[model samples]
Target: MDEVSYPSADVLKLTYVNVNPTNINGIERSGTLYSLIGDELKIANAVPGTRVFVYTVDGTLLTSSTTDTQGCSTLPIAGMSGSVYVVKTSSVTFKIRKL
Candidate 1:
């Protein structure tokens, strides 16, 4: 079966949604946005120096890191099989599907 996808940038943009935007100090920031790039999870629009944590379904810690100045970070998900994991940031906590 063929998979249907967004045919253009405009169509993609129209469907694109930003998650919760967080405000720190006095600045508003787009919170913890992520995209699957091959086996790497690319997170964007986070606060600079925000900490990111990946944990197993049972609450076991997997890995953790901090975002850069541009408010982005990537975590390699290649070593493990796909599963629902909890991703935590300085301002938010959410579930992430690794594929």
Candidate 2:
């Protein structure tokens, strides 16, 4: 007797999805890019001198910082762990949670 292996049911149903397709001009586009490392929030690829604001989920303003000439800023988010926050920049707004 011979034994054959087959893909699992879940694997068989897996389909490729282009969540972020290329732009009309065939150039890939990106939105606001940032990252949270430790207790600091780092914003990159933004416009220079842009203001970045951090607020509590309840709309309470926590702190704000301005990007430098390189379009990057790092804001301290100490003491705000385990909670959701709202970060807003000149052109974009997003949510983040500190772990």
lDDT of 2 by residue, 59-86 (tens): 9999999989988999999899988999
Put down candidate 1 lDDT per residue, 1-99, tens digits, no spaces.
999776686473454375456633443345557777787878898888988888998999888888899989998878756689888776767777866
**Residue 84 in model 1: lDDT:** 90
Clashing pairs in 1: none
> What lDDT is obtained when candidate 1 is compared to the true structure?
0.78
Model 2 deviation from native, Cα RMSD in Å: 7.7
* lDDT, each prediction: 0.78, 0.84
Question: Stretches of candidate 1 above 4 Å error?
Answer: 1-31
Candidate 2 — what's its lDDT?
0.84
Screening candidate 2 with a backbone cut-off below 3 angstroms (N, C-alpha, C), the clashing residue pairs are none
